[model samples]
Target: MPGYRKAVAILMFAVTAWYSEARAGDTPTYSISIVPQFDHRRIEAIWRPIIERLEPMTGFHFQLVMEPTIPAFEKALNAGAYDFAYMNPYHYVVAHRLQGYQPIVRDVENDLYGVVVVAKGTGHRSGPSSQRSGQDL
Candidate 1:
């Protein structure tokens, strides 16, 4: 299976098991926070299905919390505002360091890369051409 699909499956099962064993009188609502890479509406649209699936399996209410920005999301994460979180690698590292958050699973097949694109007719240069002697940008 694709890495993302596999990760989601693992997440579903893990969450279901974890919540099923919770204390009887505990709140049934769980909050899941996702990094704000897009607008809140779009983020909700993408993640709502997953949360809905978990609700039936675990018999718990799931709330999707989308922050306005990455920093805000990180702040909330550190404050333990979320019971679960789906974050980028950098955010994951910082959250783990700051809040002792443990990673449950990851999309191993997804490799992140950085690319720089310029206009076709522009004379922009990179590497040796873009750098001055003894200086880098």
Candidate 2:
């Protein structure tokens, strides 16, 4: 009777060990997409190094999946295509409501003030950027 009890215990232990080991080999995954706030080629270049560095350190393998444009990114995100992403504040809010993405951190360089100048009156508009007051262009 004691031998039967011991055999069952060993079997349970082996199954438990195997189950835990199975998932250990899998890499954690994360993704970054276009944020509603700043959708520019420059920002993508700036963020590249940071994402590369974070991949190995955090043990989270990351990939940048680019679509046709900013609006495409939003569509993909709404479709639940990524495990995680870096997005703008307004995007974070919308995604949080729509896709259950929460803010883990925000960029230190997130805030910036923009200006447009007419070059003191050339009668021609110079230094006039396309962005309106609220959106980044």
Candidate 3:
């Protein structure tokens, strides 16, 4: 989680730089959109401290934008509604490809891993199989 927080901070700095360059002589209030993994209140609680710290460091105000769902967040991202975003891996790819959003950092120490579960009586094998592509698995 610390690694994730660090990545978020680095990304914020990148956003600050971008804003400063793009809007010179103005203290831009940037909006950061996070993936809606949790409810809005919880997300605000988790990120408010980070945003407070960044405000002093960057000399800019930040607004936290929380959409109701991931797809809604993606829709706003495609519309360029945010200046910075903290998104999941798949959303990161989509945002980068479709919206030209560049990644400043990632959580290297804590990478995301996927798991697949099946019922015990289903006769399904758990191990990797030749029939399964990486995406299918």
**Residue 59 alpha-carbon offset, candidate 1, angstroms:** 1.2
lDDT per residue as tens, model 1, 1-137: 25545656756765665556555555577678878877888777767878888887887888887888888987888776776778776776666577666555455555751111111222222222223311212
lDDT of each: 0.62, 0.45, 0.61
lDDT tens per residue, model 2, 43-119: 46645655665544444565766666667777876666665455555555566567665433333322532121111
In model 1, residue pairs whose N, Cα or C atoms come closer than 3 Å (at least 3 residues apart or on different chains), thus clashing, are none
- Poorest stretch of ten by lDDT in candidate 2: 113-122
Positional deviation of residue 20's Cα in model 3 after best superposition, in angstroms: 7.7
Could you tell me every candidate's TM-score relative to the true structure? Answer: 0.69, 0.52, 0.67
Output candidate 2 Cα RMSD: 23.1
RMSD of 3: 13.6
* TM-score between model 1 and native: 0.69
Give the per-residue lDDT of model 3 (tens digit) for 1-137. Answer: 56656655655554454434344456767678788888898888878888887776677788888999988987997777787677767776666567666544455555573121211222333223324322321
Candidate 1 lDDT trough over 10 residues, lowest sum: 113-122
Worst 10 residues of 3 by lDDT: 113-122
